[model samples]
Target chain A: MNEILADIERWRSAGQRIAVARIVDIEGSGPRDPGAAMAVNNLGEVAGSVSGGCVEGAVVLEALELLEGQRDAGITSFGFSDDEAFSVGLTCGGTIHLFIEELNW
Target chain B: MSSIYESYRDALQAEEPVVLATVIEGKNVGSKLLVFGNENIEGSLGSSELDRVVSRDALGMLEAGTSEVRHYGVDGEARQDDLSVFIETHSRSPQMIIFGAVDFTRALAAQSKLLGFRVTVCDAREVFVTRRRFPMADELVVDWPDRLLERIGGDLGQRDAVCVLTHDAKFDVPALLSSLATSVGYLGAMGSRLTHEKRVDRLRSEGVTEEQLSRIMSPLGLDIGGRTPEETAVSIVAEIIAIRTGRAAPRLSETTGHIH
Candidate 1:
């Protein structure tokens, strides 16, 4: 969140609704630890990151869904350990669990 | 902007040592309690009792600069897993105090800053210990290393580092002597094998125990065969990481087939 403070401030000033994805837990060799965050505005702009580029795209998609009111604030796990082989996964083979939510609070 | 977020941003941006405890896997998920330094921070994690217990634990996490999920029962009972609170600690950046403003001092200071350490270059010689020489350093102290350590040593902890680059016995002895009195995690010195051998005897004479001497990584840095100052700086910081993480510094040729 510290890394994206500037962007969040900019988007907020412009009255852009934002959604944030925070890594709540990581298993095995994750490039980033818990609390790594990424924010996405309603316009699809991104700020910060929750992984080493491998999962940011997927996180952005989840954040966008939240912004679009397609989902409620909840947990979304991604990694090699997931059943979907074709899904976005970390190259390092680590699992990361993210809590996706709107910045309404 | 939400008042809670405004206060959180203000405390965190100032590097005032704050913690944000969030309920990620429990009832009332997304609830937040912002704990900053000893004050009853804004927001709460459900109940007042839960806030009190989490605040105490958050302070401990803040001091250690670690982020992790801790389990607790509703209302914060001791031996239960009804809730999981993510305690994210935003500690002030760890400090790296480099004694002696030499060529290595300049390179090391730059490297330390890159690694997010608040660098302080200390030397008795005012001429060398100028801001122009070490512009990257957060602080330029024109004082003996012992005096500087005496003032701020108590605050030093496991995340902090002290590097004594001044091989001169006059400076090195007092520097090591006073540094031993602090809880600073990493104590390293710059020198060759011969210089370290001599330093051991001098430090022993000055009453530094063998146990204390063991903590000092004399002849600092991994044996990366780095000749240039910049390369040596990389090796030194790598060594510091290895020391903190307890990873084996495997030289390529010396290691068995496996690199992992």
Candidate 2:
């Protein structure tokens, strides 16, 4: 969050709807720890990251869906054990749980 | 009226200790409660009872400088997972107080800053401790090492560090003695092996116990075979991280288990 505050303010002031995804937990061999976060604007611009560049694109997709009202805010998991494993699993073979939500608060 | 994000951003920008507890898996997902170190709270985790319980837990996590998820029953019961709150801590940066503003201090100060430590370079010689010399230092103190420690030692915790780069006995003796009095997690004195042996005898005579002496990582930093000041700075900060993480530094290829 600290790393992306300037960008968050820039997007907020520019009247961009934003969605935030924060890592709530990591099971094993995770590159980043909990509290790692990323924010995505409705325009698909992104700031910060929750993983080692492996799952972030998928997270951006989740954020965009939340922003578009196609999906409600909830927890999303990415790992080798996930069904979409081949497409967006963590290369380190760790599981990461992220809470995706619009930045309404 | 300030929003929760505004309040949180202000606290973070000011480098104050703060925590954000968000209900991520339960009724009222995304409800946030901002918990400050003083036990003051802004916003709520959907109920006064939940707020009371989570604010307490968040305060503990803030002190440890960790963030993670915690489960609790609705209305804050003891053993239930009805709600999962992600308590994200925003603690102030750990401090690195470097004694002696020498060439090594410049490298270490720069490296410490890179690792997010609030670096302070201190020495008795005002001529040596100059802003021009250490542009990356958050503070430059032109005073005796012991005096500075006496002033700031109370605030030193398990996360803070004290590095004594002064090899001279006259300055280092007092510096080591006073550093032993603080609870700083890392206390390392820079000197050759023979110099450290002599310093150990001096420290023992000064009544520093064997256990207390063990806390000091003299001839500090891992044996990374680093010769240059920049390389030595990397070794020292790497040692600090290893100590904090409770990991013995070894090659990743050498160890097979969890890398994290």
Candidate 3:
């Protein structure tokens, strides 16, 4: 979050609508811990990351959908599991829960 | 129309501690509550009672510098997992105070900053303690170690560190003694085996007890066989991380352990 603050500020000043995806919980063997954040503007530009590159592309898609109102802000889980599986699973075999929301308070 | 992003950015830029609580599960998905010291809060969860309870828990997580999802009752009742709140804390970065502005100190300060520590390089010698020499350090203090610790020791916590890179007995003895008074988690002094023995004797003569002596990591850093200043800096910072995480760091191939 600290590293991407300048970029966030720049995008905000240019009046870009943004959505944020934050790693809220990790089940096991996660690459990044909770609080790892990624931001995506309405233009689809991204800053920061929540995973080691495995789930980021999927996360950007989620962010754009949230911005477009196609999907409501909520938790999105990505990983391989018996119950459900994501196409972009974590190679480390951990389930990460991300809270996706717009930048609006 | 104030955005949470603006509040978060302002808090971070000013170095003010803050925490963001998001309702990830239950009735109010994506709802947020911003919390600071005490019960000062902005925004809210769906329920007033839930907001109160979650704000209290957020402050605790902020102090520990932890981020996690916690379960709670819908209206803040206990023992009922009706809601999940993800509390993300923005705590100040841990600090590293290096008590010698020597060659090793420069490398260590740079490495410390890279590892997210706010490094402060202090030395009594005015000539050696210059901001130009340690551009990576958050601060370059030209003062005796004891005096510098006196001003900032109260803020030191288990995550902070104090490294005495000055092998000189005159400077190291007071530095180590003053550092011991604080709760800084890692206290490392750089020296060779012979220098450590001589320094130990000097510390004993100065009336430092055996218990206090054990707290210091003389011949500082792990046994990584690092000879250069840059390599030694890596060893020291690695040791700090291992110590903080309670990990007995060894070569991965040498031990069978659960990697978390």
Best by the TM-score measure: 2
**Native-vs-model 1 lDDT?**
0.88
Off by over 4 Å in 3: A81-86, B205-207
Candidate 3, residues B1-260: lDDT per residue as tens digits?
A: 66766777788788888998888889888788989755688888889999888888888888788989899998888788999888889888899999988999988988998888998999999999887898898888999999999999989988899999999989999999889899999999999889989999988898989998998987889889899999999999989999999998998789874466
Q: After superposition, how far is residue B11 of candidate 1 from its true place, in Å?
A: 1.4
On residues B111-213, what C-alpha lDDT tens digit does candidate 1 reach at each position? Answer: 9999999999999999998888998999999999999998999999999999999998889989999999999989899999899899989999888888999
DockQ for each of the predicted structures, in order?
A: 0.48, 0.88, 0.71
Please give the lDDT score for candidate 2.
0.92
Between candidates 2 and 3, which one is better according to DockQ? 2
C-alpha lDDT of all candidate models, in order: 0.88, 0.92, 0.88
Better of 1 and 3 by DockQ: 3
Candidate 2 residue-wise lDDT, B98-171, digit = tens: 99988999999999999999999999998999989998999999999999999999899989999999899999
Model 2, A1-105: lDDT tens digits are 899899999999999999999999999879899999899999999999988798899999999999999999989998764455467888888999999998888
Which prediction has the highest lDDT against the true structure?
A: 2
TM-score of 2: 0.97
- How do the candidates rank by DockQ, highest first? 2, 3, 1
